[model samples]
Target: MKYLLFLSCLVISITNLYPASAHKVEVSGDVGGTLHIEPNDNPRAGEPSQAWFALTRRGGRVIPLSQCNCELAVYAQPYAAGEPPLLEPQLEPVSAERYKGIPGAEVVFPKPGIYELQLNGKPVSGARFKPFEFKFEVTVAGGSTQNSRNLRDVNGDLVEGESQKLPTWAIALPILGFIGILVVVLQNMRRSGE
Candidate 1:
């Protein structure tokens, strides 16, 4: 009987050892015409800057400013595992992509890793300005931002999206209850026999 209780506790402990990783967000879209990025240099303060991209005639001509609240936003993450990247903005617009960032936004690639840029605009129907998006990669110098991507896992390995299951407390309580029930039933049977 004691051995059963001990075995249950051991099982619960082994199950609850590791931490879990959070779910990652993914953003993707189409790159219509010439995707223009300006200067393509490290950003400096008090500098006039801009970025933009053109759409092919097939995907529709220039995205009208009025039709779509044409605005650009950028994101960056590690290349190996698809995860939610960080966001940075000076006021609203970034001046990297030719200020052409008007139709699509310019993303600042601080770190030297694979990054994604999203050209977000108000949704449009048929002849109107259809929503557009595209994902691209950029490399930055090492240690660019305060928060960097930690993709590696335990045992000094790069274990992305891999997390351990079940916390110790969550597994232990159920087993303890089961053992208590078994002990009570066995004692009752012995008493009945006497």
Candidate 2:
């Protein structure tokens, strides 16, 4: 009877540590490797992007995480007011125990802001399936501010490109903003003169 009680206690402790949602997400996979999104790695803009993660089990049980048919959702919220509105949340499907929603997959940040990725899955019976989630600070490539400039290296020189470089939109923003202000000022002057 004592042995039975001790065994039960040990099982409870192990179970407590292996909650269903123990996975951790990060920009780099070195962490828990729940989800890793490469900068400018977005494959499809209007469509869902592919995401890959190694699903693992916490116990000696013979169940697979893939049995749960995990679902992934991504959301983005702008950090600044007066910025563009938030984008519609995206739901992606998982293929195999490893997740790959869309081919050439990428996490699309409609605008620079804090974004969250959520993972929900069910494990085999007698196994815990906790919902996993992580938030990443995504500064989109283009914005009105130079500090937001996304620059890339070009043959030892910096050039504007989509990945790790200044994007064309980044260059255009200041110019466009200046032109917009000029037009507004001129219209106001004309109204005052009249």
Measured by lDDT, the strongest candidate is: 1
* CA lDDT scores, all candidates in order: 0.46, 0.44
lDDT of 2 at 58: 43
Q: Per-residue lDDT for 1-194 in model 2, tens only?
A: 44446545654544352234233344322122344444233323333344545444344222233344455555565345454434433334445334443211245555544565555455445555454333533333333334334565656665544335456876666566656655766676679779
Residues forming the 10-long window of minimal summed lDDT in candidate 2: 24-33
Estimate candidate 2's RMSD in Å. Answer: 22.5
Alpha-carbon deviation at 82 in model 1, angstroms: 8.7
lDDT of 1 at 4: 61
Which residues of candidate 1, in runs, are more than 4 Å off? 1-33, 40-49, 56-60, 79-84, 88-107, 124-127, 141-194
73: Cα error in model 2, Å: 1.7
TM-score of 2: 0.34
Model 1 lowest lDDT segment of ten: 19-28
State the displacement of the C-alpha of residue 151, model 2, in Å, after optimal TM-score superposition. Answer: 18
